[model samples]
Target: MSILITGATGTIGSLITARLAEAGAEVKALVRQAGKRDFPAGVTEVIADLTDVPSMRAALSSVRTLFLLNAVTPDEVTQALITLNLAREAGIERIVYLSVIHADKFTNVPHFTGKHTVERMIESHGVPATILRPAYFMQNELMVQQTLRDYGVYPMPIGSKGVSMIDARDIADVAVAELLRRDRAPTALDRVTLELVGPQALTGAAVAQAWSLALSREVAYGGDDVAAFEGQMASFGPSWLAYDMRLMMAGIQAFGMQAEDGTVERLQAILGRPLRTYDDFVREAAGQA
Candidate 1:
């Protein structure tokens, strides 16, 4: 079976590509640049703009499953819908989407809303679909590591609502299983909302504590102040991303976007093994750093 994965160079997408290749599925990756290849030689690299239907269709031919993992910037919604339509046209039987937790209610945030829109598109498109809605990534901790080391601050707009931070690798494992399973019942594929999660559901302060231990220094948790966090994000990202970040922070704060335990148990059963913990992810990331 052939599988097509978008966002081939990203953190999570890279993991998905590698795992699918290891599983011996014919792997195809859609990249925007023709000359800029970063993954293994085994992956079939196709150059196509994700927003272009004709371009996407060329890459989607003969693909049985598509693992959707693109991280969008500020762009028109029609661009994404067109891509999904192309996926359908190319005879993709099953589609797996990487979505944000609580995607349905995240209208204020452009990125989360973007994910929700795509999920809707997938449901309407008549393809077998499984939506993996993971919470904030454990890899997200690395963004503030240097700040915590230099200034002892790990600020979050995620608010007091504890997030069940997930490791991207684990999410990849789950997605791979969903893609490879041939006997998936229609009821199983109808509307699967699997909340990929870490073993421990920690508050923001607890996440900081893990960082402090990893860095061998103190890391303080700054309160949920949207303006301050937006300022920090603006300095690093484009203005639209900063605006999207703030809107997302508001959702996490008000809706308490933490996952209940059922999702974790479900993930364990699906994988036929225990899930990785945040500590395990932190050690690997820290070692790489």
Candidate 2:
């Protein structure tokens, strides 16, 4: 079975590619540039951009399954719609989309709305799809290494709210199960939405404490300051992205982005193992640091 993964070099997609390859499944990574990025040795590389319809259409050829994961960009919805249409046209058997936790509920947030829109497109277009809505990624903390090392702070705006953040590796494991399930039983997991999250719900302060314990240094929560968070993000990314993220953080602050009930149990059923805890992620990250 040929499985093509978009965003193949991204956080979740790259892990899925490696896992699929390790499982001896025929994997094709749809990268924007060939030879520029290194993929798993056994995986095939297809140079195609999501915005480029013709290129994407060509990439979909002979692909029985597709892992659809687009970056958070201004044209995210447009790109995803184009890819979904092309995938349907190519007669791809299944699609596994990487979406955020509570995407349907958080329609006010741009990225969340964009993913929900794509989910609708996949369903309306009659594409057999599985939507994996993973909660806040524990690996997202890797971005604050500089701040954590220099200022002893965890700079996310998650506020006092506790979020059930899952490790990206867990999301990848669930995605691999869904993708491979198609081969084992064609009707299994069709048009299913799985919310993936960690076993525990952790507040911002708790995350900081975890980091302090793991790194053996003081780490403080930066508090829920949307303006400050947006300013920090704007330093590295586009203003629009900063704004979008600020809205998301604000939503979390106000409404709390905790996982739905039974999320961990469902994830454990799929993974056949316990979910990775925040402390486990922190220890692994500390080792990397």
Candidate 3:
């Protein structure tokens, strides 16, 4: 089964690509530049931009399956809508979309609302797709590792409400499984949505405690301060994206990203194993520090 993986250079997409290649499936990575040859020996790389319709058309050529993962960008919605239309035109058999958990609930977040719009489009257009709505990725913490080490503070402002943080690896595994399942089927499968989550729902204080245990030092939970978080994010990236993330964090603080009953069980059942834990991820990050 030949599959086209968009956002192929990204963390989750790269993991899916490697796993698919290892499983002996034909994989094609859609990259924006021609210089990237990072895939395993047999995997194909297609130079295409999400916003470039012709390039995307060429990338979708002869591809039976597509893994749609668009990074959070200003034009993410346009990219997704255009690509989905192109995939539909290409008569792609399967599509696995990486979307955020509680996209519908996070009404104020730009990226969240963007994905929700895409989900609506897929449904209304009768696109044969599997939507994987994963919770906050534990790997996001890797970005703040240095801050955690230096300041002895966990600064995501996740609040007292619990969030079930899934590992990016688990998301890749579930995506690959669904991709292979759809690719090998005799006919197109029905539209499905999978709520991917980790084994435990964690709060801000719990995360800080986990980091404390991992580093063998006291770590304080940074209080809910969306403005401070926004400023920190804007220091390194665009203000627009920082504001978008600020809204996302605010939504998390309000509603939390907790999974429904049996969500974790269902995710484990899909993977046929236990999900990776936040504590384990914390320990590894701390050890690296």
Candidate 4:
């Protein structure tokens, strides 16, 4: 069966696309610009925009399964809904949605709320779907690589409260499992939601220590300052993005972002191996640097 993966060039989506293609599935990568990047040998590149429903029609043709991954933008809700409605119209058999962990509880956060809304739409739309709600990505630390190397500090606004950050590759593995399972007997995962998290919950200090061990340097936890965080984010993007991120960080500070009990166990069952730990990710990242 052919599978269409949206956001096919992104961190998690690229991993899923490669794995699916490696498994010999007919993989169609939905890219806004087709010739920009190379894909797996057997993968087909379909030029389409999620916001334009008419443009997606060709991409959804003959697609049995779809990995819906929308960008975290202000128009996330509209974009997802448009694509989902088109997928349903195209008679797609299965959908795997990449949502955020604790999206239901974090309604105030724009991106989280958008995912929750899309999840509901998937359920009500009668599409057999698996929702993979993953925690904050451990790879997110790569964003502050410069600061870590120069200042020896982990400069995120996650605060002292712990979060069960996970590796994007693990999330991709689980997504591939769900997509490949269409040939197997119907399981509990159909129309089910799973929280994907790492082996342990870690605070800012723990993250700093992990980096220190990996880089062989003294790395300290930079305290959470919303204003400073917003300013830093704004330098790279728009003021609204910084504002939204500040609110997300503020929410994380007030209410921790730890995973639920048995989250790791569930992920292990899907992966058939131990979940990747923060230290493991750190060591690998350090090696690449």
| Winning model by TM-score | 3
Each candidate: what lDDT?
Answer: 0.78, 0.87, 0.92, 0.86
Root-mean-square deviation of every model: 2.4, 1.4, 0.9, 1.7
Over the stretch 192-223, how does candidate 4's per-residue lDDT look in tens digits? 78888888888888999999999999999889
Residue 188, candidate 3: Cα error in Å is 0.3
In candidate 1, clashing pairs total 0
Least well predicted 10-residue stretch by lDDT in candidate 1? 182-191
Candidate 3 matches the true fold with a TM-score of 0.98
Clash pairs of candidate 4?
none
Q: On residues 1-289, what C-alpha lDDT tens digit does candidate 3 reach at each position? A: 4999988888999999999999889999998886575788788989889998888888898899999999999999999999999999999969999988999999989999999999999999999999999999999999998888899999999997889998999999999999999999989999999988888889999999999999888999999999999999999999999999999999999998988898888888889999999999888878877
lDDT of candidate 1 over 133-224, digit per residue (tens): 98888778788767777887778766676777787778889988987773243433555668788778677688678777877788778878
Between candidates 2 and 4, the lDDT winner: 2
Full candidate order by TM-score, most accurate first: 3, 2, 4, 1
List the candidate 1 regions with Cα displacement exceeding 4 Å: 182-191
lDDT of 2 by residue, 152-211 (tens): 999998977678888999999999999898755655355888888898888889989998
RMSD of 4: 1.7
Q: Estimated TM-score per prediction?
A: 0.91, 0.96, 0.98, 0.95
